[model samples]
Target: MAGKSIIDVLENIPREVIYTIVLIAMILPLLRPLGLPVPVSEPIKKWYDAIESLPPGSLVLISHCNLGAYPAFDSMQVATLHHLFSRPVKLVFFSIDATGLVVYDTLLSKVDPKAYGKVYGVDYFHIGYIPGGETAMKALAEDFKAAVPSDYKGTPIDQIPMAKDIKDIRDFTMIICFTSAGETSIGWIRQWIVVRPEIKYLCCVLDMMLPTMRPYYEAGQVAALTGSAPGGEYEFLIGKPGSGIKKADAFTGAQLILLVFIIIGNIASIAKRMGKGGVR
Candidate 1:
């Protein structure tokens, strides 16, 4: 230890210490987030504004299609639902895939619309999973009742006051889909958006799908777009810090720590080389 060079010391940082620091950085934020500021990007800002600008009593349709990978889009869905519930809009949730029903229920439980003074049958409705993929989406666009005759709980749609007027896709004031696959968005675009061009469309998709949808967004087919890391940004913009905020805080802390270590290591290497007359 006495003869060890500064470079050696810096490069030999104990794996245990690094792991411990990283663990603390992640866990602390989950327990008590630092409330760090997250910058709002154009896409997320657009998504927020689209919801904020909706008129009261406007009915919204949300399509959930990523059931197996809930963790990836859970924060986005929660934050979106929280924002929607905060407004005067009526929401109708449906799934494109069978597994999406489980994910939808999980998110509903976590967001707890009841806490926001929203009633199940009066303020919001959940129609559960509808199979047939593109064909089902087309049917829903033309005749929602025929596509989904009952709610997720087997209750007739006619019994739900909020769903009484939702006859087809055009009945919705806005359409928002959180999907992990391109087919989900493409189906909506072909069956719903193309048929009813007036209905506003917004999507929250995986980061990789951004390129596939960017052209539509640019052409005004999608009023707003957000995905992946932008979920945290949306949470920040909404001023309702949730899991996304905590995750962002931890991510920022970890990156900062990594940057600091990189700087120190470089400095130590340079100093050691200078002491050795630049031989190394």
Candidate 2:
């Protein structure tokens, strides 16, 4: 990244004001959450409701496939996890992205501190980052424990309460791929959903991906979808109605700011084209 220079200095002046405005926009709405009925798209609603309805203690496999980024996606990840926790599911977390383990561990700590005692190697497990990405996914589908002998805390699978019963990938009731990347979701669909033809597969991804991933959802490859904070806010508003709702407001404000900037730029360009040199 470059340090501030003349143009950077000029640009940064408005940045602070814009940030404050955005902060207020987000905060005010959250403090008084819009209760905006962001219609839960059927897929997302189904996904959310499914997870919400799970019997407590149901084991869920959460894979972080994206190299965790931004508070929006990260927050969404946490929101998803919180939803899982609310259902009181036993979470088995892993990641294909090298940085994924660190992100999930951090998210767990921040999102639900009390749940930490859910036991690292017992109720909750971290299989750490697996290399070979897609190939590893295929391998795990065959023999999950063989692919990773131990969890993140260095405990053997046989010794762990959850793993003791989970002999292979088929053992998991559902697979939740929380990622911004398509690698895990696509691989799970190919190697697990298609091959096994039993276990449920859901994808929690960034909203920007909906266009491309819609086909997979339509094809029944993904059982459910929850992308971006709008989905998170929708869930939160119904329950806690906290940061997720606020984040949605900030998102709206940021979009408005961009739209204003675009309109101003277009007006300037039109003025110049009309030979007035954008004088106004």
Residue 118 error, candidate 2, Å:
3.5
What's each prediction's clash count? Answer: 0, 0
Query: Each prediction's Cα RMSD?
Result: 4.5, 5.9
Number of the predicted model whose lDDT against the real structure is largest? 1
Extract clashing residue pairs from model 1: none
Q: Name the runs in model 1 displaced over 4 angstroms.
A: 1-36, 253-280
TM-score of every candidate relative to the true structure: 0.79, 0.77
Worst 10 residues of 1 by lDDT: 271-280
lDDT of each: 0.84, 0.70
The reply for model 2, stretches above 4 Å from the true place, is 1-43, 55-57, 65-70, 113-117, 234-238, 264-280
Q: Write the per-residue lDDT of candidate 2 for residues 1-280, one digit (tens) a residue.
A: 1453333333334666767865676667666666555554666577777687777777788886455454556655666776776566788888888888778767776667365446566567788888897898888778888998888778777888777777676677788887777666677888888886667787877778778778988887777876765655545534644455556655676677767655666765565566665222
Task: Specify the highest-TM-score model's number.
Answer: 1
